[model samples]
Target: MNDQRPIVIIVFVFIISAVLLTKLFMIQVLDDSFLKRAERNAIQRVVDHPYRGLVYDRNGKLLVYNNPIFDLMIVPKEFQVKDTTRFLEIFGITKEHLIETYQAARKYSYVKPSTFIKQISTNEFARIQDFLIDYPGLFIMTRSVRSYPEPVAAHALGYIGEISGRQLERDSSGYYVQGDYVGLSGMERYYEDQMRGKKGVKYKMVNVRGVDKGPFKDGEYDTASVAGKNINSSIDMELQKYGEMLMKGKTGSVVAIEPKTGEILSMISAPFYDPNSLTGSDFGKSYTALNRLETKPLFNRPIMATYPPGSIFKIVQSLIGLQEGVLTPETTFACNRSLVACHNHPSPVNLFGAIRNSCNPYYHQAFRQIINQEVSSNTYKDTEIGLDIWREHVMKFGLGGTLGIDMPNEKGGDVPSSKYYDRFYGNGRWKYSTIYSLSIGQGELLVTPVQMANLAAIFANKGYYYTPHLIRAIDGDQSKIPQEYLTKHDVGVDAHHFDMVQDAMVQALFGTAQRALMKDIQIAGKTGTAQNPHGEDHSVFIAFAPKDNPKIAIAVYVENAGWGGRAAASMASLMIEKYLKDSVSRSDLEKYVIEGKFMN
Candidate 1:
């Protein structure tokens, strides 16, 4: 304003020229910056790994995605980290760590590049990367490591790591080279081929000092990398997060499925870890720590554990009896505790009442009728025939076998066969009474929690079920999933029979599992206090909400809990309420399940 423009311009130019001249002296006299560009160097072909696909929950919440990382790769012969003090200080590592890493890397290869220090976070590398040019033999390579914000689903969304020797040899696609990363489990492992896009190679001309000059052959010899296809999963991240929280301080699993589409809403295995912890340089340390855990956090109990299904199996028994025509709605059995012990409920209950009360003695008599309904010459022969038929019908509900969920090493679960009985009790020696305990869902029958969730799906769908699955679609298209997952699997039982069972399951919430019944949402559920011979009984419960046009079907198992109503059903009720309403109305119950210690 006071005619100072000429003075300001003169001073600005003087200061800029002085700074520029100083910088030119540093680059020209001290070290070469553009000098490497002036001397054309040899082209180094670097393999560029495509960014792994991003994973998002059903509502577009990001579950897993790529984060930029720098791996310090070394060509042992070409790399030299002189000045131990400077090297250690620059990298923020100890002398022993540098030596051990170098030796281990050399064992891999002396000439070829191998990762010396893997998975350095972007922020950490930013601090030292400017000084990396002073070092030789070591070069920074760009990579993407997995990052999880919530750390909710470690088992459901498995992590990625370097391809092992066995994996490399088995790769028939010829896509993997050394130092490639691959999906190891869950949705990652299932859709590996699609999730990991094709790799590209770039040839960059560099000087003898390992400095990049420019693209080799004017970029003619380089192939561009294509990022992986994004996957849209059916998991409700909020529900998954809530389920995981409810299962804290306990040992068990909670799996919820969409009754119509079989899209898994949530699959929670307790003692879970944050997926973020396994991503950085501490991956090996985290793996070893998790491996040593006595709780066996790595063990996926939902799809892997086998336990007697307890009173929940009564639903299967009730259906099998109806299909066999040996038991009817009008059928009554006395709960006199004559054959098995009971906790003093009313006697001579009908089928509906039997299911409502989960009367063990009533199921015992009902199972006996089905097993000994003389279609054959003798009762023994008839019992074997009926038992075989029952098992076949039961298998239709995806029991005693894998539900074919998109997970690796999933257990098919065990359902005792005649051969099983023959080996254990001798073929002809066993009959209905000898194996009467199975009538109450005990003795030799084992089922996975996934299978149990599928059973709830079957009941909700009324005699038919789509396979319970984790994937909804790939790349936002629902058709990308396998055809079998969409196909309806029907149990041989009549659809009308499920109505009675549904009513009974609903009545159970008002009776045995009243704690599980939420206001305004009619939840149909069954309680299972399973016998654990070595210790206390395990708590188990299965339920579906809004009985008509169901949205969520859930199954919960709490090890060493006293009863299903206490832990399993209570937690399940909270989950159902949360999913349907988007917030809980039962804060008191939520606090109990979240804070209470159910097991010793």
Candidate 2:
């Protein structure tokens, strides 16, 4: 009976143990929500930023590079500050700043990391590293700040900044996270992907004391960051520097393009700011200062500003007239001095002489002939048809619209159409006489310095031009032009018309703009004193030299500089000589351009 009782008790105990084992299996294997949360609490995923690409000039000179900067980051969930005062002193931040930063970090998320201090110098970073033992979960992250080697071309190279919220929404490849830098303007903005390299990831293991133990899993899951591809720009650094020097204390733009390749050699927008001003710890303040400057140095005048082409428009008008067979190169017109009457000149001037003298009446006569020509024999007999044809010829030279240059935010200067004339003058009611001022490049005909430079390039190329571009290549590979940009449209003028125009332009240098000629160099240029409705005339000069096998074509506009033969012309000549021959032929001419003073 005693043995039977012992067996019963043992069976009862076994039954109870089985029930507890089943319950443990249900909690451990069937339900895993709590265990997954525990695993997330312990595992930390950190992003490793890739190094940004470097920018080089056409000569492979470094333009933009990166300087290592340290950011003080805090993981609030793991943060344990033993001595707050010591931490603040090491980081060179105030106690109030630390408190505010801590509060902000907490608000972001306890598990998430946030940067409390930014752009601490290398020396400060060393100090922080030595005292890191006093602060747990506070770490130093190495980041890069843009550094400019030459400190010029602020508008061309542009600057990088933190990605905005709007940008994140637009691109969700996780390519950019918080605190990522992005190109904001110029070529930088235009080629963001090529410039911003792929980011890599690395898993790191840390000890309880917040010290990095080593790579997790022997670096098997780690990725090496791919540095951004190197960029080769088309800018001639020396020419760009010289142009900026010529434009010192002036308010205007100068754009020089290689006539053969449509490469922008030098583009200077005056009142320039140092690109170094927009980097490091003082970036925000310096940006604000530049934004508030009176002259608006940040504005890229070459493409952003539009002015009347003035006498430059006469060149296009003459070409259109010749192409339409309305006028020949030997066709003569008499200039009448009387403003109100058409019968003023009996002294007949040929096309060459008329262009050299910048005869307004001759172009007036040519413009009238163009407006009278019909698009087709059976087409509508509207005067706007001829004007439209004239506009088409002008546009073929890359006017009246965006030139599709590689730079960001280029303005397409106004090219009024027949429809626009219809709106202003009523349908078929206006005559070419009503818009005679168009012959002289006035009355709503606007062009930018970039467009002006392109016009000179077209003439230099004798027919066609590559789309003006700033970036020459990325990582040693030449940039491919888009198909739309490769098509060439003619200006409707034959080869003979350009030759005559070139000859006249050369004569203008020797005749009207004689003062602009440099010794031993034959410069073909035209001067323009464009009337400014707001202030004094804007002096402008467009030129290319040594006339045969031209190397550089340029346009310079000096606001309120009076005549184009004065500051604008001299500047153009000096720049041409400096670029083509590597030295100005006349130091006296260089001195004149350097020291020339403008009245209003």
Candidate 3:
């Protein structure tokens, strides 16, 4: 036992010694990784951030471009700070700033390069470049910042900023690192990979003083960065600017679409800030200020703001009725103002006249007939099946959900179903009268401005619509856009059923929206005044031009605006005129819209 114990002790000592010796050899001799790591003390990794993609309007007009900016980078070990006074004067920073900033740089890294002062102007860089060589540890890193020339479509183009720690972790692509800028919203965020391009690495040898010694190994290990692909958007910059002009001083949204292609022509969220304000050195300050405002200038209203679709939704009801065989163009309903009081127009209105006059009682009975049709012996079961069928057909119109537009934070508008009612009112407890408000496009029928424009496109195409999209082409190739955008989505109603609705909508100009009539250019439009619980009623309108072979479909909403005919219908007509005629002949009407007379 004693001999075995001695042997065991010797073996344990030998094992510990062998393990230590193997690790020492691996670190000091067998493996060169440690030596390579130590060699990095003299090597500098200059990160090359690729130039982000340029943005252009459909007509090839430059919308977003890059402007050169300079960052004073430093390697804590290489930075000598020879003349702190000259450094402070050149950078225009105080002495206290230098101390704190330099300390922060060292905390970030003892050997790696870090940004000391960012977004210095070209003149500032030129003044200090000559003296920069004298201070070995300090050098200029050229970077490009986004620039917007037209300052239109601020919400659609989006902005870029430094990557957050959270973003770094979620970046499964491993394309981003600290100090990298990423798309924060809008089209920028949707096509981040294409717009960001591939980041290239260049390994340059630097001396102890942080002076860049030309390419290491004659650029054997260096690679050039590939610039991001340019994006050609569907926006007509001129029309977008005009829409913004008309919407100024108002809180609302507007979206225009090409009915056949579903390409967005203009998307305006009123009370917008200049896209340039969120770029360059002013980004942090400007973003903070805009974010704090109560009106939410940064809030994207075109795709995010949800409101009752209002009377324009009556078009859906009319279509659904015709498809279900519940009503005909000649079908008449008495508008006695008892069931749902509406503006006095005619005593009894047929479906066509009901639509033209925007009568509430017509849809009230028509909607009840839709949900209480003689489908089952049990009325409750019949109502449930009928409403479910109605909702399924409505979903085909791209309502009750997000249209899947290529933008961030697109809200899916609400359209309550049977389950929603079942949850609220319990099993078989709710009836047709309980949900009667839905008849006039009120109650739970909420929609975004983009969705409303899509509804107009559906009407223009008879019974089908293309999912609305902002990107027209990517990588200079139209094929690069998603296949879904190219596909046609049909709303199940027969095409002839749309003929009746289309005829009725055009006749509406003679009744409710007389002011929306465009000279010679035929327009089909619907006006809506949505009830608001918090403030004045919201004005809304949806329209398309040229009647047949329509070029553009549009939706406009004006918050706190009294009636649809006054503000919304007028805006839609002016936009249609500008698109079709290439110039607005109605100078007086254009003046009224641009001056915001209707809003008053």
Off by over 4 Å in 3: 1-41, 82-86
lDDT of 3 at 191: 87
| TM-score to true structure, per model | 0.90, 0.91, 0.92
Global Cα lDDT for candidate 3:
0.88
User: What is the alpha-carbon lDDT for the whole of candidate 1?
Assistant: 0.85
Question: Which sections of candidate 2 miss by over 4 Å?
Answer: 1-43, 340-347, 374-381, 479-489
Instruction: Give a tens-digit lDDT track for model 3, residues 101-206.
Output: 7899899988778888888889878877777767767877778899999989999999998889999988898887677889999998898889998777788777
lDDT of 2 by residue, 1-600 (tens): 987998999999999989998888877999887776664554455667777888888888888899999887888888887777776666778989988988999998898779888888787787668777567777777788889878788888888887888998898676887678899888888888888988777767666556776776778888888888888888888878887887888899899988877778888998788898888888889989999989999899998999998887777777878887888888987786553232223356888877787777777777777777655563334467777877888898889999888878999998888788779878767776677778788888999999998888777766667777787777877745334434464555677778888888988886557778776777778888888978889888898887877888899999988878788888988888788877666877677777757562
- Candidate 1 lDDT, tens digit per residue, 527-580? 999998888899999999889889999999988886888899999999999999
Candidate 3, poorest ten consecutive residues by summed lDDT: 591-600
Q: Going through the candidates in order, what is the number of backbone clashes in each? A: 2, 0, 1
The parts of candidate 1 lying over 4 Å away from their true place are 1-41, 93-110, 597-600
Candidate 2 achieves a global lDDT of 0.80
TM-score for candidate 3, residues paired by index: 0.92
Tell me how far the alpha carbon of residue 227 in candidate 2 is from the true structure, in angstroms, after superposition.
0.7
